[model samples]
Target: MAPILQVDVDALRQLAIDMAHAADTIHEFDLTQPATGAAESLESSSVAAISQNVSWSLREAYRHLAALVDQMATGTESAARIFEAAERSFTGALRRIH
Candidate 1:
């Protein structure tokens, strides 16, 4: 198994807070049909439309989540790079000290 790279914990926490805040901004409403004389037929049509709309909405939501995840992943990668750089620098500095 490949060893997991260490990332800066603070960066991870910041990214999670950012993503959660962004996600919170999104508002979703129920797509229920209003009662009317033609409610029966409207219900059928609305059902089909609801299915399509929900699917589209879900797809869009998934895309947004994926983008957010990628952003977090990029931040994590940066943290990993910083950790590795700090490790190397400290190693070199220790050698110089000795």
Candidate 2:
């Protein structure tokens, strides 16, 4: 049987914050310098273009990842609230029964 895992909502939120910082870091790269090559040819431009495209794509991917992480954190917090409410309700019910 698989062990049940308990997650801390506050920790998840912190992780989301960390992911957002990482995404910001990735988006801060400067890709203005052209690529180095053996000769001053079209290869440099092509390489530079490709590098810029890759960097842009990576930044966008990280941005999306951070957004997703934020959503997870929010969901976890909501779930925690719901669980707390349920526990309170259950406790009240037990008190009434006693």
Point to the candidate with the largest TM-score: 2
Q: Which stretches of candidate 1 lie over 4 Å from their true place?
A: 1-44
lDDT of 1 by residue, 1-98 (tens): 22234555566667766665555453232223332333445566866566556656665776677677667666765775677677677777777988
Query: Looking at model 1, which ten-residue stretch has the lowest summed lDDT?
Result: 27-36
lDDT of model 1 at residue 80? Answer: 56
RMSD of each: 8.6, 6.3
Error of 2 at 51 (Å): 0.7
Give TM per candidate.
0.51, 0.60
lDDT for 26 in candidate 2 is 51
lDDT of 2 at 30: 44
Error of 2 at 48 (Å): 0.6
RMSD from true fold, candidate 2: 6.3
